[model samples]
Target: MDIKGTGAIVTGGASGLGGATAALLAGRGAKVTIFDLNADLGNQLAKEIGGHFIKLDVTDADAVEAALQEAEGLHGKARILVNCAGIGPPAKVIGRDGKATPLADFTKVIAINLIGSFNVLSKFAARIHDAGTIGGEEGGVIINTASVAAYDGQIGQAAYAASKGGIVGMTLPIARELARYGIRVATIAPGLFLTPLLMSLPQEAQDSLGRQAPFPSRLGRPEEFARMVAAIIDNPMLNGETIRLDGAIRLAPK
Candidate 1:
């Protein structure tokens, strides 16, 4: 899965993990297309990195199809697909007020995080499959983003955890199925990272969260995650698995 001189598609490529990945691949000579809901950031990043940007909403099937068509038109059919389009608004199943959370909250999380990833991955893979084998040995690779919370969610994270859990649960099965097509599938379960969402917290709060990690206690760098993505793309044997990109941190119950 050499990235140089190939086509790659990264969902949610406007910011955070996906943005880092897009930059990494583009830097390595891949023709990257960013599929993101934020046209402003996506367009800015595209120009900055010399990649293309397509406004996309991963949860919409028709929009996904159309966006991929446009992306492939610009970059050719993508041999790399990274699913990083997700949302995590945490809520407790039972609040301290004694009322259970609204069912809509759970559904929204599932829709955007779980089903959204699948929607983009499946559509992108299908498009690339139709285009045929890419470089030499492999047709394509798919890297999905999960979270540490999938395994050890804290309080007020039932919806978020369940959504991520579905991603972890499906990685191996999807990999097995896609193996025949010379396509590899893997997921990354990141620990506490200083993504924009977390960085918005107070400085002390951020430090406190970082200190929770067992050793070398600090938030993860986006470049670090990008490098792991490159490693997975480079190694054909690293399929059907989810790699945890976190520090040695198991979250508390909270």
Candidate 2:
């Protein structure tokens, strides 16, 4: 769909992949709204990009609804919703002591990574469907963030992988159900990327991670992820699929 003058919402747009997407969408003339927990960065980035910012906890139902309402008030209902609010704190299911991981740790990941995505998507789709077609397009698009862990989770990635797997699992069914409304759903399974957190790592560690990618031998860039988002947005034929952005790397069990 044409992005110019359209409305879009990107969760966790304060930094990393989401931030890159918001910037790209705004640069393309779409009215963008950034939903993130980081209020200061969100506000700053919004000002820089000529977009609005809303502090939101994707896991909080009331807050998400309110945030969306606030966003629509500023830029109409967003037809482009990018789900990028997630966290991955790795821990083994059974440690050296043979103690099982804390249930809370696992649940928290699922809550934020999986349920949080659904929370935003369900609300966004409802509003988009209610608003009907957008600028002659059938409906809208929802891009979810997954991880290579979903396919080849390492030793400490059980929770993280499960959460991402939920996103992958739901893509097709959700797309088929929303087909009538013209809302498409897709996902991106990213490999190691030079996100801010990773950038802080020692150069040696960073280089090691980059070399893990077979051919490119480098971590993916945030702008590259943003470009993929744009391609997915423009290609209506791309739906209900998860495109692995990794450079031919199936992560080894750590």
Candidate 3:
């Protein structure tokens, strides 16, 4: 559980929360590997952190396996895996145009956000299981990213909410299954965070969103999320649970 010198893999490490987690883990002396589709940013971040970067699409099983091998080659088998690669494209099931949301788009969201997470987690867990235990633990810890939308989704978030809800729903069972191997599973259901996707909105829109928070009245920071991740890694008893990183904000139906 000690992060110092531990091997860690972070999916979607090119930017946003994943990038922040990578930097924090590196700062804590963990040997980090970044798995992302953004080759340029991934490579740069790997260089900056003195770690490894694998250009990978988490949804591709073959690519995920190959990337895991590459990461193991660099830092041995990873003891910490963080699933942060996800997409949130907002659309109503039935829009004002009276057209139903495209089924393909909804499926894509689930593919990337839910199935993609499983792909990386399964690959990493297999490697860890094969390599055996570290520090008396059969494996390492896994942190998955969910969203507050999973609990209280605003309008036009059907796809995103379903995907994230799947993540939240999977936590307990996965943790129970991994316990024999000493692999902990946890999830973070984040509130409104100022990720690139949110930043692209008009400033006024951004301000309005921030004002909705119950406390501090602002978007969560990536570093704040990173801090929670570090805490989860260090605390052995924290397992099989989803922690909401929202500032006590129950979103209204938009």
Number of the top-ranking candidate, with lDDT as the measure:
2
At residue 75, give the lDDT of candidate 3. Answer: 84
lDDT of 2 at 41: 93
Off by over 4 Å in 3: none
In TM-score terms, candidate 3 sits at 0.96
Put down candidate 1 lDDT per residue, 1-254, tens digits, no spaces: 88998899999899988899999999999999999999999999999999999998889999999988887788778888888888888788888899999999899989989999999889877876655665666889999999999999999999899999999999999899888888999999999887889989999999999999887698888888889999999999999999988888999999
Cα deviation at 82, candidate 2, in Å, is 0.4
Quick one: ranking by TM-score, best first? 2, 1, 3
Superior by TM-score: candidate 1 or candidate 2: 2
lDDT of 2 by residue, 1-254 (tens): 88888899999899999999999999999999999999999999999999999999999999999989998998887889999999999899898899998999999999999999999999988877867886676689999999999999999999999999999999999999999998999999999988889999999999999999997899999999999999999999999999999999999989
What lDDT, from 0 to 1, does candidate 1 have? 0.90
**Rank by lDDT (best first):** 2, 3, 1
Per-candidate alpha-carbon RMSD to the true structure: 1.1, 1.0, 1.3
The digit string of per-residue lDDT tens for model 3 on 115-219 reads 999989988888786566677764789999999999999898999999999999999999999898899999999999989889899989988999899897988
RMSD of 3: 1.3
TM-score against truth, every candidate: 0.97, 0.97, 0.96
Would you list the C-alpha lDDT of every candidate in the order shown?
A: 0.90, 0.93, 0.92
